[model samples]
Target: MREPADLLITDCSLMTPEFDILDNQYVAIRDTLIIAIGKAEEIKDKYEPKEVLEGRGKLLMPGLVDAHTHTCQQFLRGRTLGEYPMIWSRILVPFESSLSEEDTYLGAQVSCLEMLKSGTTSFAESGGVHMHKVAEATIESGLRGAITCSTMDTGPFIPESMLASSPGEAASRIEELYRAYNGAGEGRLRIWFALRQVMTSTPALITLMADKAREYNAGLHVHLAEHRDEVSYCLQNYQKRPAEVFDQFGALGPNMLAAHNVVLSDGEIALMKERGVKVVHCPRSNFGSHGFPKTPTLMQQGLSIGMGSDGAAGSSLSLFDEMRVFRSGLHAFWGLPIFDPVVIPAHELIRMATSGGAQALQIEDQIGTIEIGKKADLILIDINQPHISPTHRMIPTIVESVNGSDVRDSIINGEVVMKDRQVLTMDEEKILYESGRALPRVAVRAGI
Candidate 1:
């Protein structure tokens, strides 16, 4: 005589962040939330399901969370390779400047398609020009996370297209944006505050935007300490490291998500630890010659680290690619003859993409894990293929072997947005067609 669940998934290899693998378990969803979770055989007949999903060969976990990305840069992928150091000035600036508001929206729309196909259900979009376009795209595509405008008022070599006219203008834009879009898409999207970076924004802009973030009770996102040259610049200008610069403004805390801490020293890491700042590690972007962040050292120090793709510009849109590359990054950290589990185990790596990512955005209590009473943001990866056959352990098989394309289904907020690898929210063919046509226009406009 109980109310029925809208949807039920049975016989799933349910993986939770606490390292519990509930083989042949079931989950129930109703009204944008998980109403029940239990053994599949036990609960198969308990409630009538409007739509029952057979998950016999599927691996279910909280959908992968990209802690930091630039959906607006989705169109610029594969073009800026080998242009690092000068990439921003020579490549990104012009490309970003060339984008119309519609262009930004299309980039976000296409990025969301890639993310959905790849098993990412939630992602924090780093600030970009015309971010309302991002919100619109997120709402249309049915993903969850923060989006923001690039808050810049001062700095050198910044394109006029990206610069705000005044400090007041930047602050006002953030306030207005938060007021308008902070809780859009039924509370899935949060419009947070962002400063382009020290190299682009004046300290005044950072302090103002930081104050605005605190005022609105919103998370502040920024790109910091990505390169050694950035650290040198901070030291010469602010007379401190990047972490010290943020600390001086009282802007280092759980409310802050610092992306790409590849150049932090011992003291800087300690400062981040002392302030409880979370980090988003874009492994592939800072991969190869630039070197990965001192992640093993930081993880040992108890810093909560999350994974990100940094958009098509820096890396792939798939968090699964980031996950595989993350393991490789660890292997490189310890030199030759790597024993993977000794440094960082597979499950812990999985944590960085799930719960760790949610914690980075200060929303762990809501999403990031599979639990009763939590929002049902889940991905079901069909691992019955040749590469992933003989799955001995759930987490290891997922972290080590599986890639994003293996995601057969993606569910956000108890709604099946994608099934059998076909996205239900948007037009994939049209999006692909649009992107094909759009990229040429963008390239010609940016003259890249």
Candidate 2:
């Protein structure tokens, strides 16, 4: 008993988990939500729409969701490559200390443009040093995101301004952010809590962050077990694995989303599954840092696994590239013909980058799928190109073959954010110019 749809998409291949292809379909959308989906003729007869999009020779799928990213790090993309984690940290913390508010905003604009052009509709951003700028940029870019004010308390690596003076101060700042932005921009933006990293944060601070997040009904994002050195450091100092310590602090839950859980034990995987805790597997970041693990093992254990790019510094912020790496790398690791790298499959890869990531952010019901009552977050891929021609299998081809450049349009919350590969929200040229100007200053400050 809802009103008729405002828009309809017709004659396209719609990707779904149960089946890869649906032909000549029409998806009805109204007020930022999908109202109905069916055969073109059937839906056209059922619901009158104000606008109809011809999806002929195009693939219509839910928009990609980046489970983990540092939006403000796009300016540092190529600069941080080839350095170990410790060296990476040394360069990053000092560089971040010198970033002006204008620099932060410009960096976010560049990152948002990159994400949208690459077909990402939603992202979870661990906003560096300045959270307000990151939130403002996300709002301006027409991208949905879970933004966190990164908290660090340790004396090592970072300046005092970047670290919270005390645990109480950190909690207070998080409360202020939650109160101001938790449901801002008509729920397009959400505020979450970040504990920075285990090595730098105290046990008391971790427990307090968990408590605050629960009180606010918000999600917690953190990095865990990304490197052997991280594990060794935790073991040497805390006499516990990072995951176990987090578990002791009452931090494992569906609301908690851990990034790069690469070095977890079988027991830790079991614990994550039992608690319904989700993980963002940045295969590119893992390969760059500590190499890939048996993620198929984590998947087999029924833990929700989503894909991430980590950041420009960790990997190029393209989910398409991540999917390609995932398919080939998992195949290489298993090396069994019947194992079928296709078992995880391309359609599922798209799903993980979209719906699975939304679930990790606890926004699945709102923005992940293109179902009735779900947000109209979707991407249109131009399959008419020579490389993507004769699309016999649309979903698989999209995952395996489609690059970010093939994204013809990106729609978020019933609005077209990018059309014909042109970004609508921000001035891309100005962003690039300002970012170029700022990078040299940042490099000099870090002595890179």
Candidate 3:
């Protein structure tokens, strides 16, 4: 007369929030939450599971959370390689502006499939038009996301179609999207307000969007101090650094998720620290375009930092790759300088991908860890492979050696979206075919 579990995974190595690996562990999922987790032998017979996944040779851990990405930029993958700086205006804007609703949907489908198969259970859309399309793709793909609409009022080279008439219009549009999509898909989706960036947004729009997000209890996503151009623009326009501009507008808060942060002044970092602003580090994109960010310094200051792929346009939609790049870059930049090779150790880096990412998105209470009452958003990695073999130290191996291809299963919100490397919720073949067919039309429209 034991409890009936919706899904059960037994005989797996479970990863704790502390980054410790527990062998012979079993996790029981009932509906959308983890109901029980304990030693496999002691707990295997306690539940009558509707479905059971043999987790032997697999590691069950909290799925990676991508704190920032661009679903609409999925098709632009490999298009910006070796491009100059300010590709946002030179390349990305035209492409995004040219996309139709259907185009956006297709891009989202491709992006979702890439992320899910690569072990990302949750992500935050950096902001784009036709976000409903992205939301639809996310819901259909069974992934969790905080999505936002692209909001811009004034900036050089911005397309007329992408600009809002005024700050009020931008705030109204974002509020509408929040009302329509926030907490959608059984709370798997949350709508957020976007500032796009300091250069693209006016002070009025920034303040208004911040106020609206607070009113709706939603998050505000923005790119802060991401590059030299943005910092220069802010200094010229407002006589302040980019992060300082947000503080001046009273727009910095816990609900604000700022990406890149490649060029923050010490004062701005301190201000952001005081305001509890979350940070998303896009290592591949940032390092190539802007120099290395103050990741180690930010971590030392106790900022909540998360990893992001920034979308497939610049980097692969895999947090595993981001983790590797971030760690190596940090070791070279900070570690070599200070003669300390252990700068931002592997365990801490993995924490940034998991709990830190959930914290950045303000969803830690629901998803980030393997514990009872938390939503069952998890990934199973087949670690019995050649690359990850001889797993002497589990955490280091996960951070250093493991790649997205090792992800054997992905479960989000208690549903097994990908099992045995095959995506269950998404039509992979149809999406791949459609993406190939649509790219030519998109390139023509984008004038790429």
lDDT of every predicted structure (CA atoms): 0.84, 0.81, 0.90
1-448, model 2: which lDDT tens digit per residue? 4357777787777876464567777888888888788895667778777877778878888899999998767767877668866644686666677777877888788889899999898898865867788888889999999989777888577777788888889988877877877777767999998787887788788888888889889899998888888788878987888888888888877788888888988888888888888888887878777877667788788777788898887667889999988877767766455666455667667767887898998988787776778899998888889888786776677767889998888888987788778888878888888888888876676566
TM-scores, one per candidate: 0.96, 0.94, 0.99
Candidate number of the best TM-score? 3
Relative to the true structure, candidate 1 reaches a TM of 0.96
lDDT score for residue 24 of model 3: 92
Model 1, residue pairs in steric clash: none
Badly placed stretches (over 4 Å) of model 2 are: 1-4, 45-48, 336-343
Candidates sorted on lDDT, descending: 3, 1, 2
Name the candidate, 1 or 3, with the larger TM-score value: 3
Any idea how many clashes model 2 has?
0
| Candidate 3 residue lDDT tens string, 1-448 | 8889999998999999888889999999998999999986667888999999889999999999999999999989889989987888888877899999999999999999999888999999988878888989988999999999899999769999899999988888777777787788888999888899988998889899888889888899998888898888987899989988898897999999999999988888889999999999999998888989888889889999998888888879999999999999989988998899888899888988999999989989988899999999999999998888887898888888999989999989998899999999989999999999999999898898
Lowest lDDT 10-residue stretch of candidate 3? 173-182
Candidates in order: C-alpha RMSD to true structure: 1.6, 2.2, 0.9
For candidate 3, give the lDDT.
Answer: 0.90
Weakest ten-residue segment in model 2 by summed lDDT: 334-343
Position 132, candidate 3: lDDT: 84
Number of the top candidate by lDDT?
A: 3
